[model samples]
Target chain A: MEKKTRVLLFKPGLDGHWRGIMTVSKALSEAGMETIFFGFKTVEGVVEAAIQEDVDVIGFSVHSGAHLEWARELVRELEEKGARGDFLLLVGGVFPEQDHEELREIGIDGVFGPGTVTAEIVRFIEENLGRKVSG
Target chain B: MEEMEEIRRGLEEWREAKKGWPERREEFRTDAGIPVKDLYTPLDMEGIDYLGDIGFPGQPPYTRGVYPTMYRGRYWTIRMFSGHGTPEETNDRWRLLYEEGETGFSAAVDSLTFSGVDPDQEVHGAAHEVGKEGVPLYSIRGVEALVENLPIDRMSVALVVEPMTSAAVTSMYFNVAKERGLRKEQLAGTTQNDILTMTIGYIPWGSLKPADLLKLACDLIEYCTAMGEAPRWNPINFTTYNYREGGIDAVQEIGMGLANAVAHIEELLRRGWKIDDFVHRLAFHLSAHRDFFEEIAKYRAARKLWYRLMKERYKPENPDAYRFRFHVQTAGSSLTAQQPMVNIIRTAYQALEAVLGGTQSLHTNSYDEAICLPSEESVRLAVRTQELIQEETGVANVVDPLAGSYYVEALTRELEERIWDYFMRIEEMGGVVEALNTGWLFNEMSKAFNKRRRDQECGAERVIGVNCYVMEEEEPTPPFRTNPRAAEIEKERLRALRAERDNRRVAALLDRLRGVCERRENVLPVVSELTAAGATLGEITGVYREVWGIWQLPFVA
Candidate 1:
């Protein structure tokens, strides 16, 4: 039997556009993943929830262009706490294509912008977790 | 018999060959929650009567339009929605848009100011908000700053405000006009005093108690109705569009909107106000989404429904009260941040749809809406989209061009039935207020939203820039960038305005305003007094908070 992948999804700013986050949460839950939604969190708030929840991966669903700096800042926080390389970080929303390379360098393993398939997001996380189990 | 059997066997083989070639069938539904049929024939509209359901344009129960020549005589007003940073910035943009052929102004205030506060307040900066959402207004001065270069007397302004603090905003605009030596009779504009829906969605922001909100809304309606003829106050805005953006299908949008209209009418009738006195100023703010045919039908059905409800149910004597006048704003959610230019095309299509649907006025979304505040270039393009439809398309030559078409009439009737079902369902649940309180509407929206997302993931629906026709190498930088100093600039402006004004006058007016709010007197006159006295928005709102208290949002957010 395959173990369920626990994913903590959150919004990092005061922005209240929750349609994207809510829809994704529904998708992950339907796909049999234990999706914990920490609705509208600050960077520090998200970091604290990650530790408290002890999840397999963290995904930031942001639309307000502050995702680039936020992603970089969260990665640094994870590294300092020795949580880096242990869990995967995923980013989604209306991110421009150019920011993809920079986000990856900051320890982000995946980038899902407009037109992103929820199944693709689920598959990526599941396969990476599967690799860990097999290795 | 042998030859016939041989032919049947060959046909069976042909049928088997086609078995797995096509994708799964998809369901099509309007945003109003109406399930759309694949085809509509005369059979579908068998019960509908041409003279009764959809009569000539400008007639009672106007399914076609509120006017005889709708677009033929005058095209729908190109009402551009523009507000950001400071009043100065917003005002400058308004001038630019007008120069680019925009026919009217639709103001978008910052969230802080919209909630009735000064830009320099503590809540403004912590939200990382500032001019990110809209222009920050403080008092009559901010209103003055917004219309400095623009012609106030010449233009029609639509203040997108809820009833809670609309009196104060409208009073400030009136005060600005008074200063400009323009008569109240000369002011041509609309203020969205739709109080019912303010509490219907987003539990955090609406008037907490229905009775109190209704009282304030009634006061505005009464005040505007008495102002005599220049038609300054647009007291009621049936915001079906807001719900549409939040994922409610079209039928629910119309149904809930009509339910809200019913709520307003019931309140007014209970208060002994004549129906004709208050209904004329009522206007609708509709969303023009991507669905071309369905959208047109939705508008047609809305007009007919409103007209019939007013005439048959209320029996309002005035012909004007029975007409459904509305403004259309293109859907922002349909626009993608990726391949932002494609939004221009999307906006143009929606704009054309609005005109064909017989909108009184229209606001086409800027291409940059998915990302940030629209730059001047993008704003101009949005305005031009409306102008192009008016000048080039020749679509404006008739009113409701698709009215008599069998497909359109059938679709319109189907849409009417679906919306009526929603209205009935909500009424059974103890009206829109109770439905909103219990999260029934939100649940419906979430369910539909999930299905739509599933379709996108399963490749049932195609969003060109989002799910299909994506470009991997294209890196087009957006033209607009929000100034981080917007908060600071607004703060300085607020401080200076406060320092320069008469301190005693501000204090006296605010104290008087607090007294009136607590005494159950109509707060409009008091708010107007405070605005004229040069009191800040924060001061006015603080007084109301002391009297009425802030709403505690019901949701878990």
Candidate 2:
């Protein structure tokens, strides 16, 4: 039996913009990935859960313009736990395109901004994780 | 009967003649899925009576305009929703908008303030979002700084907070007005204390149960309007705009709004209040979306439906209770991030729809809002967009200029029936509160989100920059950055306030608040005193959560 790629998604901080993250979660699930939606969590809590669940991808969305701050906090939490390279880190939300490089520099593996299609995200996950997502 | 027969015969000939010409698409429908014909004639308006259905302005069934003179007497107030970084910075922005000819002010608070959490709270890194989404008004001092040196006595201000913190934040604003030598009765403002905003529009953290939220919402209306505490202030504005931005069409938008208003009305009535006590002070906030004619008809249908609801159900004696006055905001969901300059044109057309629909107030979205908060220059352009409509365009000169158009009148009649039908469906589900508890409203929102995503992906709904006329690679606009030291500054302000305020007095008042919550009484009188004594939002709402436990939403992915 093929092991299904597991992905975990959440909303970091207290921003209430959940449509973007929920849409991505449903899309990934439809594309045949084992997706877990941890609704609202702290960076430290999300890191601990991702490691315990053995998820291949850990994604979070930010629409409160605190993308840089949250991205840095998540990276720091993972590094402190010696799990920086254990999972593919992704961040998506309503942020400027110029911030993509800064987010990547902060150790984020995938950066999706506004106007992102769900298929593009599905393709990104499959290509990066080297697993074929069957729908 | 003879005249109607003649027009019907002529319309049949015209329909046959139009069959030879090729149409643009196989079918035409409004954004709400109402089928549209190639042409509308006098026959389409078959049973609609002018006097009974579309009466004169300011009369029953206000289909034309709410007021007799509409924009001819005075143009709609340009009330922009704005805030950022800190209360001081937000005040500066308010002054800029005032200088640029804005008539009203609206405060947009941050997430910490929205959820009744202070920056120093140990929950979920609340400090990171201190001043990120909007201005942080944690304590009474922040609200005072937000309206400092402004003519709040003359111009109306809108505090956009929801049920969880509406009592706390609104009391802070009222206390500030009183200290500034303005009587509470003389204050003119609005509190966006809608329950659905926090529940369905955008789910806040630590939200109360739906029934508890209703109690909090009706408490404000009971305090300000029914109790005559702030006679001129609009205690609650049913903000349908927030939910519409979540991808619902115009019909669902107004349907949900009407049902939500009914929930509050029933709650107040159950509390032993007459219908006329707070019904006249009820107001609405609507959205101006993509469909040009449909949006215009929506405003008209909404006015008529409100009049009908008041007449057939409540029958308030006050004439003003029947008037469905609303503020329209250009749809933020319609704007695209690619080729951001095109959002200017989109906003302009939507603004015209509001003007023609006879809105009482308007707010135009900035072109760069799809990416980040608007830059100073971009916000200035947004204010100018509304100015162009009022100054350059002659659309607002006449009241309800398109009142007699065949397409508009017919569409208005069609929409009224459809919206009422949808409203009844909600009423059948035991009204809005029961629907919230059953997770029915959330299901509607989730379905809309998925359907919209599918439509855009398959090219069924063509967004200019996202689907068609794509731009390969372009220079990104310079994003506006918020103050980095906002969190530190706000925390310091809170610390200073705690040291200066009388802690013993605040604690006693908090104890009184707990008793009020236990007995389920109005919290305004005690909350006003607490805010004046320098109690923060977190402290006031913390008591409510302790008394009535937090709600666990029946949310599914």
Candidate 3:
């Protein structure tokens, strides 16, 4: 039996937009990933859940302009705590096109913009996981 | 023999196609959360009435439109949601929009002013978000700067105001009109004074308990109607779009919206006012979402349901009272923040749906709405998108263009059945306000909203950026950057107003307002007085909060 890909999904702000995050969570689960959703968590709450869940991938979905700052802080915290290697950092939301390179430099492996298909995200995770599963 | 045949079929298909299912598979869900089958036929509709349900445009029930000629007679008003930072800035933008051929203005105020707080108030905090999301006007002086040199008589204005302390803002506009000597009848526009919709979305400013909110709402309705702002001052907009963005599907949005309307109508009728007197000015602000067919069906169902509810439930003698006319805002939630540019395409689709759904007026979400406030460049594109649809598409040439189509007609009926069923559920839950108070409505929206995320995560639904079409390297358009000093400019305007204006009269008018609100008396007349006295938005809201006691809901994620 193959072990499931454990994924944690969360929104990092009080902003009430749940549609994008909800759709992405559903897609991940249907792609055979085990998912736990932390609804609208604070910065501290998200980092705590990351440590507790010890998931393969941690995704933070937010539209507020705090993504770059949050990612940098999270990466710094993870590096200090020696948990940086365990999780692949994936970030998505109204990221300005110009900030894509800057976000990558902060340890985000994948960035999804509008017009992206679900299959591509699934493929990104599968490739990142390095576990080839044939259905 | 049967087993052998199945094996052979499977083998042949596997050989021909590497994957068993179609190569590009995606799950499609309606805006109403209805699962769409491969095809829908005439059998789906079963029974539908064209004349009774849709009718000729500009006729009874108004399923198509309230006007006979719709866009053919006159185009839907291109009302840009303006007003951000300060009065002067908003006025400059308004003048530019008008010059660019916008027919009307829709003002979005900052949280402080919208909630009825003065710019200098401690409640505003250091981070004054004025002009960031909406225009922050402190007094009639601010209003003057916002609408300076504009043709108040010729151009229609829609102020996106919640009734927390809106009397001052509204009164200021009226005072300006009066100041310019424009006839009350010549002034045409809407004040989005819907306290219910504002309350539901969890605005942190001054809110009211259900009872007080209802009273304030009634006060505004009565004030506007009796003050003879008959054609203008659209005090009621049963806004369900907020619910939809919160995660309630189309059916729930419409069902709850109607229920909300029912509560208001019941309150007014109980007060001994005839329904016909107030129902005409009542309009709906609906969400024109991306789901093309579902949105169209939702509109059609809303018309049929509202007409039946008025005729059968209320039994109003006036024909016009039975008609349901509404303005549509393209779904802001549907636009992705990820692929920002693609939002334009998404907005176009939603706009097309609005046209097909038959909206009275439409406001397309600017492509950059998800990231920041729209710039003039983007706002123009949004308006031009609509203008293209009107002038070039030839879509508005006919009435209910898809009225009798098999797919559209069937979808319309299924939607109606589901909505009526949902309406019964709401009624069972003790109507709109009760359900809202109990968090039933919030829960429903949250559940669906969360489910959609789960589906996207599991590949059941495909959102272009988050789930599919992974972009390894790309550039997102630079968001329209606003001057960070917008709030400073607005604060200066407020400071200037304090130096000006009648201090003694303003104090007296504010006291009068407090007296009426405390007594639960008709406060509109006093509101007019307060505005005339140059009482600020914050002052009016402060008085209201002291009386009504702001609503503190158990916060929901």
Q: What is the lDDT of residue B240 in candidate 2?
A: 90
- lDDT string for model 2 (B1-557, tens) is 89989988888888888878998899999999999988888878789899999999888789999999998899999999999999999999999999999999889899999999999988888888888889999999999999999988899999999988999999999889889988889889899999988888888878889999999999999999999999899999998999898888889999999999999999999999999999999999999999999999999999999999999999999999999989999999999889999999999999999999989999999999999888889989999999999998888888898987999999999999999998999999999999999899888888898899999999999899899999785789888888889999999999999999999999999999999999999999999999999999999999999999888888854
* TM-score of candidate 3 versus the correct structure, residues matched by position: 0.79
TM-scores for all candidates: the values are: 0.85, 0.99, 0.79
TM-score of chain B of 2: 0.99
**Top DockQ model:** 2
What is each model's TM-score for chain A? 0.89, 0.97, 0.90
The Cα error of candidate 1 at residue B312, in Å, is: 2.3
- What DockQ does candidate 3 have relative to the true complex? 0.12
Decide which is better by DockQ, 2 or 3: 2
lDDT of 1 by residue, B416-479 (tens): 7778787888878977656656767667667777777776666666788667887863656554
Candidate 3, position B500, lDDT? 84
Relative to the true interface, what fraction of contacts does candidate 1 keep?
0.13
Model 3 lDDT per residue over A7-123, tens place: 888765323345566567767877788888776455456667778877788887645344676677668778876788778888876556667789899888888755445667889
> Where does the lowest 10-residue lDDT sum fall in candidate 3 chain B?
B123-132
For B145-189, candidate 3 gives per-residue lDDT tens digits of 888999888887887776665566777888888889876667777
Question: In model 2, which residue pairs have backbone atoms overlapping below 3 Å?
Answer: none
Docking quality of model 1: it rates as incorrect
Q: What are the candidates' individual DockQ scores?
A: 0.19, 0.83, 0.12
